[model samples]
Target: MTHILMIEDDPLILGPTVRALTAQGFHVSQAMDGAAGVQHAIDDKPDLIILDILLPNLDGWEVCKAIRQRSTVPILMLTALSDEIDRILGLELGADDYLTKPFSMRELLARIKALLRRVEMDLQQGRQTDRVQVRDLVLDLGMRQVTKNGVELSLRYKEFELLSLLMFHAGQAVSRAEIFDQVWGTDWLGDMRTLDVHIRWLREKLEEDPSAPELIQTVRGVGYRFTAT
Candidate 1:
């Protein structure tokens, strides 16, 4: 059974959601505040996190940012219905997916299953390759490691995926949509911020000048393109 960490303040939604997930053979841990959510995520390392944007102590945005800095664990944001901006912001802050309020339990279950499957795929793939090098930088796929000029770089999973994708598309621009689809999967319903956050993170890791990155470039209203140059 997959273990899930869910952080939401609503008792009505939380109770039903927890019961539904438990019925489907998921082992779940629940929290009502962002601080607790973050602690539980680090301590328990749940398969995935279902985070609420309106959390107490720390909002989902802060929680996501804090988590992204230290871990690449997949995060699914829970937002209020009609809060499209919140959905987009959550993605920009490194959320892997978002489910608006008033959504069906069936949909949430499907998303959880998909995320767990992707996590498994990433772990399996990590075992297949310890490292991939392009130019002077090295990405250790095995340890989820990266190096710059022979020095190690601590990269989150999404950042690592960004680097891998760029290496695959070396010497050409890779569209933002392609990057998001490849990294987060096509089944994800979140906005394009998922791609944007990862691309930005990758730039900060691999580029000497993130503000004017030479490796990943914006394509001006289209998407991003990455080259080893």
Candidate 2:
């Protein structure tokens, strides 16, 4: 049984959503507040988390940061706000995906399925002992950690995925479309800017100078290419 932790305060939304997910054969755990949500996430170790932005105690953002610091579990953030800043911030904070509130059961389920599918694919595809080294940066596939000059770098879930993909095909121009399909999945419903944002974040972490990046260079008409140093 796939365990899912949902942290949502509104009973009306939480109750129905939980029931609906249970009907789909998922073991659902519910939390009405952000603090309880974080606790459940840590103690229960769910396969996925559905977190709402507005909540009592710590907000969803804080809860996300807390969880990201410890675990790499996939997070699907639910928000009433549609601002671009909110979406970008959620991504930066380590959310795997975001869905706006007032969504139908069909849409919610689709998003959940897509995220779960991506997770399964990620787990099954990688080699157990694979390690990629480009210059001073080292990515350990088994451990899912990146180190620069022997120092590990803190990378969000998507950031690590994006970086790995780029480094795997170093010196090749990976098109934007190909990258979106590979990293975000073919069923991705997010904005195009999502990739650009992730790329920028990776550059900030991996590059010696983000303003003038030497590694992970942008192709004029294509996408990005990670130049092996």
Candidate 3:
């Protein structure tokens, strides 16, 4: 069962969200304030977090930034703040997704399902011993580690998935649409620029020269190809 940590101040929302997640076979832990929520996340190491913005003691954005400093656990922010700037700030603070108040329960379920599906796929792939390497770069799926010149590379969640998929389909040029479907799910309607941002970050980490990447080549007008030979 996937365990979730939810931090919210509103008693009404807190109860309903927990009950809903529990019904979906998820074990949930609740924290009424940001400090406790961050602590619970550290103690429980939950599969994901559902955090509220109007939290007392620390507030959601600060909690998110602090938690991200310690772990790369997936974060989904729930906020009454509906402004685009507020949403983007949450994302920049290391949140995987942001949902505004008055959101449909069905949509909430769909988002959770998509995130769980993506994580499960990546976890399953990480447990397999078979791996693919290109030049000095090594991807040991079983160990869930990547290495370049025998030095382990620390990649964010999305970065790992992007590299893993590229290596899995070595020579094929994967289009942006295909990447979106594979990583973010087919139903996701977020802007495509999100993918580009991640790709740019991934290149900076994996490439000797991000400006002129070699192993992971960007085919103009098409997509990206990982040549691991």
Q: lDDT winner among the candidates?
A: 2
lDDT of each: 0.79, 0.91, 0.82
Best by TM-score: 2
Q: Across residues 24-54, which tens digit of lDDT does each residue of candidate 3 receive?
A: 8899999999999999989899998988998
TM-score of 2: 0.95
If scored against the real structure, what TM-score would every candidate get? 0.84, 0.95, 0.81
1 or 3, greater by lDDT: 3
By TM-score, rank the candidates, best first. Answer: 2, 1, 3
Model 3 steric clash pairs: none
Per-candidate count of clashing residue pairs (backbone under 3 Å): 4, 0, 0
In the range 24-130, model 1's lDDT, one tens digit per residue, is 99899999999998999989888889998898899889999988877778898888856666667777677878888889998988888777777776666543445
Q: Write the per-residue lDDT of candidate 2 for residues 45-91, one digit (tens) a residue.
A: 99999999999999999999999998989899999999999999998
Q: Candidate 2 at residue 133, lDDT? A: 91
Model 3 bad stretches (over 4 Å): 23-25, 69-72, 82-86, 125-129, 189-191, 208-215, 227-229
